[model samples]
Target: MTTFDLIIIGGGPAGYVGAIRAGQLGMKTAVIEKASMGGMCLNWGCIPSKAFIESAKLFKKVADAKSFGIDGIDKKALKFNWKKAAQRKDRIVMRLVKGVEYLMKKNGVEVINGEAKILDKEHVQVGETKYTCDKMLIATGSRPLRVEYKGIDQSKIMEIDGFFALEEKPECVLVDGGRINACEMALMLRYTGSKVTMVTESDSLIPFLDEEIRKFVMDKIKKAGITVYTKSEITKDAEDGVYVGDNFVECDVILNAKRRRAVLPEMGDLELEMNGHFLKINEYMQTSVPNVYAAGDVTKQFFAQVASAQARTAVNHMNDIKETLDYDKLPVNIYTDPEIAYVGFTEEQLKQKGIDYKVGKFPLSVNGKAMIEGETEGFVKVLSETKYGEVMGVHIVAADATDMIAEAVMAMRLESTVDELARVVHAHPTTSETFMEASYVAADRPVHI
Candidate 1:
């Protein structure tokens, strides 16, 4: 029996960060990971998907060179070596994995390479070895959910996780989710010359986002030549296509972007509280079992771009440096062509909660930088308290909106008023000026239309 002061199961963003913090606090720690050090986000989900998206963007740029006054651009003659693209993504994943391993060594945390199962509250079994610790953290994360339609098997259909195995692009692909992944992939694949169709149960894409932004994204997706079907469900899987209600859509590949659930198969032996399979954690991220903590997608927290934010909160809780996690200021991003980044509540949410709020909106067509960049497509919406003028929420959809929303997030987190943001001087002819304009509009003053 091996013993340590702290033991972490699943070497992911949450587990690795927790282990490092525990080591910094002078506790001996060991982290057990069944697969790679960086887990799904690094190995399969986030990093790899971004790399491919970037490639798709670059390919689109070259394909559209003629629009930039550059003639004799033959996009059909251009070819992509998908094997190289896969290798490029693999290299990035490998580097990040090595970096995680290096951090563990620097923090003097031991690494165990095997699947872990909790024997008791503080004891974990890995293969033939059993280890005990004073405290344990589980950050196993989540896996993509596969819908069990007739003839849809592990062999024919591919979920988001398995979609990365392809060395070549499919001729036609069907994306079966209406949210971020589905919308993004539908646009990217269609732009990259694959006949793509997006099917969703909802009437509009990305239903969680603001209604205005959802409509804008849907229009852009349509303009990209991707067929969009709404309020439809896939009933059966045929040889090369899926039957949605009465119509069968033809496609060579199917991408499932349905809801995901926490991957906690080994938790059956542990005496922990669970809402279905998701581990239930308190405000301090402590599970039902004493000294056992769970974070990231394993917990009941909402899944989005706020994953790292939640991981940081969980790290503080695990280290006992913070008494509670403040989840009020989480920022969410949808990585579409005109990305949507939002922090705090939506107008509908505020209305439902009976919170009186004022809204300010600035369209991208009026922004000088957007017009110059030729990517004018979305808008920035700011919501504030009706009486006090304090910033309640900031939502943006535009080019580099993911990067630009940080300032708004900071302002909202600091409880800054709309007047404060409006008064601040932003650089000339920039997308950031849109924030300033929106803030001004929130105050019922407009400089530029």
Candidate 2:
């Protein structure tokens, strides 16, 4: 009987990250992954999707190359090779997968390639071999939610992974769901010159965003030439197209968004509490079972960043370290043309909680770099307490908003106020200056709005 300090199941962001952290803390660790090392994010979801997005953006840029004043480039003569783009995405994924494998070896974390099943709170079985550990962490992640409709063809309807496997772009696409992934795929497909119509079950896309930000994004989605049907869904299929209620719309492909449930592997009768389709976990990511923890998509924190943080928190608790997870402070990003990133309390959340707040905003159109790059289409908005001026939330819609959101995350983490944000000197001629400008407005002194 082989034994170790910790055994992590599923080698995605949550599992791999937790294994590496355990190694650093001088604990013997083993990660059992049934598939690729980097999981869906690196293999199919995040990395490959972003690679395709880069290609689409480049194609769009080349189509508009004349705006840059470069040469006599003819838009009509430009071409994009979907096959080449697909190859590039594959290469990028393989390279990152190798890097993760290398890290596992360097950190002394054993990589077990097989399906893992919990035999008990302390013992896990992998391919007929049972291994004992002091602690067990489940990071099995989730799978795309599948819906049933009349006259559905499995060949035409696919999920994110299916979309990534396309050798050629479809002429028209019908997408379902209103999550971040849906918005990203819709924009990317539109940029690639595909006719896209999205039917979302919710009244608004990305409904959790600040109302102002949500409206702005909805407008942008429409402006990008993608049709959106809110509070609607695909009900039936006809020879001509799919039916949303009684209306029939034509589309060659149907893509579903990111509604997912925990992929809990069969464990015989090892009982674990579940919340809906997800595993129930405490603030420390601990499950109802002793010495067992769950994180990432399996535990309801769906984003990759949040999954990694939860993994670390679970490891910290296993080592008797004092740290707790805070979902409120988690930063979220949507990779649209002009990206959107936000952190801390949203206006709606604040309203529901009855927290009195003030708003400050600065448009990117007025920023120096935005003008220089000719990509100014969004703004930075800050929310602060009316009484203390403490920063409650920050939302940004710009090209580099994803990268800039960490600053806001740090501000809220440190409980920094709008006055301090305004007093700090920001370098001139940068998009980040928008944050300072918004802060100035929050401090009751308008400057370069």
Report the number of the highest-lDDT candidate.
2
lDDT of 2 by residue, 21-93 (tens): 9999999999999999998889888899989988998888788777788888887777678899999999999
Query: What TM-score would each prediction reach against the true structure?
Result: 0.94, 0.98
Listing every candidate in turn, what is its Cα RMSD in Å to the true structure after a full C-alpha superposition? 2.0, 1.2
Clash pairs detected, candidate 1 = none
Candidate 2 positional error at 275, Å:
0.8
Indicate which candidate wins on TM-score: 2
Our tally of clashes for model 2 stands at: 0
Which sections of candidate 2 miss by over 4 Å?
A: none
CA lDDT for candidate 2? 0.89
What would the TM-score be for candidate 1 when compared with the true structure? 0.94
lDDT of 1 by residue, 333-394 (tens): 77788778998888888999899999999999988899887778889999999898999899
Tell me how far the alpha carbon of residue 351 in candidate 1 is from the true structure, in angstroms, after superposition.
0.9
Clashing pairs in 2: none
